[model samples]
Target: MVYPKTGSLIVRDGREMTYTHIQANQTPSRSVCFFFPGASYSFDRPYLYYSTMLFLSKQIDLVHVNAAYGKDIPDFETSSFAKRSAWISEDVKTVVFQVLDQQEYEHVFFLGKSLGTVPIACSLLKEPRFSRSSAILLTPLLREELVVADLLALEQNVFLVSGTADPHYHQPTLERIITSKPNIHRYLPQNAKHSLDIGLQVDLSLQVLQSIMDELGCFLDKSLDI
Candidate 1:
């Protein structure tokens, strides 16, 4: 009985932000996962798409933030990194608060990839209301000092994934977080890029994807005590 409902809201100077809410229509939703895609990645991309399915399978509802910033908002392309991050945070918060106001969810999970992780690290994860929420940061901008600092400050459980080949992957930074923050679990895939795909190795890339999903499932099970 799981189904999806799509809706849109105006945010950040009249820009449109569309989001899809998915859950079992007949079942009461106690948990929800908010998906924040990368600048060039959409919800239909392999990682986000499969993750959406995985959450639904576990009976955790989902909200896909279809914020097409680079394309829909011309200002996004010209804005500085700080400005862009703030814009993203505003858009995400607007959609998330609206959804939460409509219904109460006991558990809140934020999953972000690359550019999307900025808001998760800079805003959502820092907010008092979400201090108890968990986070899944896929290929986060490890090179960014601010993002890494925020991530290190987290107290709730977090699942972090990165690839050795990804330009954003910083060894020293990751080591620091891992050593200091025992609550954050990490997965490092060798020779994988930002997309978590092995360059031109289709089969191996698929296997990597499978492994990530498996680890994510285990994380959810353990975190939820299910």
Candidate 2:
């Protein structure tokens, strides 16, 4: 498959955000997936690449939101947590609105990893359009009340893939939350870390990622009923 095209746009707040657009080349499913990376990660990472390929293989277009910390925006590291979180949420909402306004997508899906899940969760409360959409949350920081509340509020299907050893959430708490929501499909891979890397061996990490991709493929097929 061809690589995605890079594009940049200025949001309403005058903060510039970069995104990658990948058009569907085969089946033209008319579905789109908006990807949000972790705090320090970008769309070029291996995980994002794997996800983009998965969606493309299904003929789903991709819109990957690059991290806003490195450009003209204020450094997230130095800013207060509340301020940074708000900014991230606003940025994501703006991008989503822009994309939807410009395209004619029949189905919208949000794929978020780690800190990225915060904005996806927040958008569900702030934007009514997202309430009807699906979500794939990788290593979601469920410790936040907003995340938990949004997850509870979502009536659509949600696929949550996390590690058994993720530090951001307690296993028992995660289990309880999953048990409370029948719409959520949970996957907990053993000995995996927050990034879903099994260990220091690169080969083993890639193998684990393949397993994740297989799981994600099944979830996508079920969620989209394809």
Candidate 3:
């Protein structure tokens, strides 16, 4: 289950950005998952760590996109939120193209958390080549109506995981949106927060996380027909 991590430095918009690539150990890899972490979260964070392991277990390659605001790239701490998001989107697109150029993956899955979903959604809209790629969105920010609209317009398969108590999004409104779009598979665990932690009790939180991962596994199996 140990996957080798390969690091690469790519320049985008005249700035150096670092990205990590992990190849699955399974022979003849069938798919690749592009991970976009939240604004403040890194690949090492619990949610991403566990999710990445799940995908790796399914024999999927991973490309973890690291943005400028994270500790790995702290030079853009003072940049405006809008500018930072734009830069991250470009960086994500750069890495995506690099991976596509190197391999002919049968299926590409975009995994995004919080603000990370913005870039993935935007990239899919701008690039027709990636239109058929599936997406797994974690705690998408409903505040960005444009992002939500873009996600809705995608004809490709999509799986969304959110918490009922996530402060960043109104549960009622989100539920309504998802209700109208029956094709988008969604999981909203009761009382779970943005991080998908349901309670302070260690056991309870672990249970909630396990349940979410189980749902994600099932969804992936059916979507990719693994």
Candidate 4:
């Protein structure tokens, strides 16, 4: 089947998939995003990924990628969370290449949440194409290798953001370690957390996200018209 030049679609198992694509007027803007969903959920889920749409739509055209859990969903019931993220990264890498081809995006940007950060980071390290664009990491899970890989990134513009009172992790402390090591712009929201919405209140998270998106939009190619 021929792909349309406008909206984005995913053909998984030959099924024409309707993705959560938000396309503004087709201007010369960077129209692609690598939305790496957290391990606990997929792209279509509201709480994890969808919750950030309000802030994202204003910045650029979007495509929310579902997490690939290999042959089955990752569970504490079997493998560790870290392991699942690794497996999903391979699948997500495949998806990214497919989308980049189908979407015909000029400028590429990355958006990864929680566990999604690691594998995507690794993929960028291995392949050179993804490194051409900026990376906006949301509440990432970092390891020694990820830190090492980050410094090796070909893409200079990196945005690292998280909350002060993150409910599930202590990544905020690690921010300082990586923040100055590279060309990273850091934002630890006044009181944000793992999810964009922390403390069960999304208002603060949403505000911070909007602020970040505004900055990103400013840098987007002016050709993608307002």
Ranking 3 against 4 by lDDT, winner: 3
Between prediction 1 and prediction 2, which has the larger TM-score? 1
TM-score against native, each model: 0.96, 0.87, 0.87, 0.66
Number of the candidate with higher TM-score, 3 or 4: 3
List clash counts for every candidate, in order: 0, 0, 0, 3
Candidate 1 has a TM-score of 0.96
- lDDT accuracy of residue 177 in candidate 4: 50
Give the clashing residue pairs of candidate 4, or none.
Answer: 28-223, 28-224, 29-224
lDDT of each: 0.89, 0.77, 0.77, 0.56
Clashing pairs in 2: none
Where model 1 places Cα greater than 4 Å from the true spot, the runs are none
All candidates in order of lDDT, best leading: 1, 2, 3, 4
For model 1 the local lDDT of residue 27 reads 65
Could you tell me how far off, in angstroms, the CA of residue 63 lies in candidate 3 after the best superposition? 1.3
Pick by lDDT: which candidate is best?
1
Superposed model 2: Cα runs more than 4 Å off: 26-29, 70-75, 78-82
Candidate 2 C-alpha error for residue 160, in Å:
0.9
Q: Compared with the true structure, what per-residue lDDT tens digits does model 3 show for residues 27-138?
A: 5377888898888777888889999999988888888877545565565566765566677777778777887787778988989999888787766545777766788888
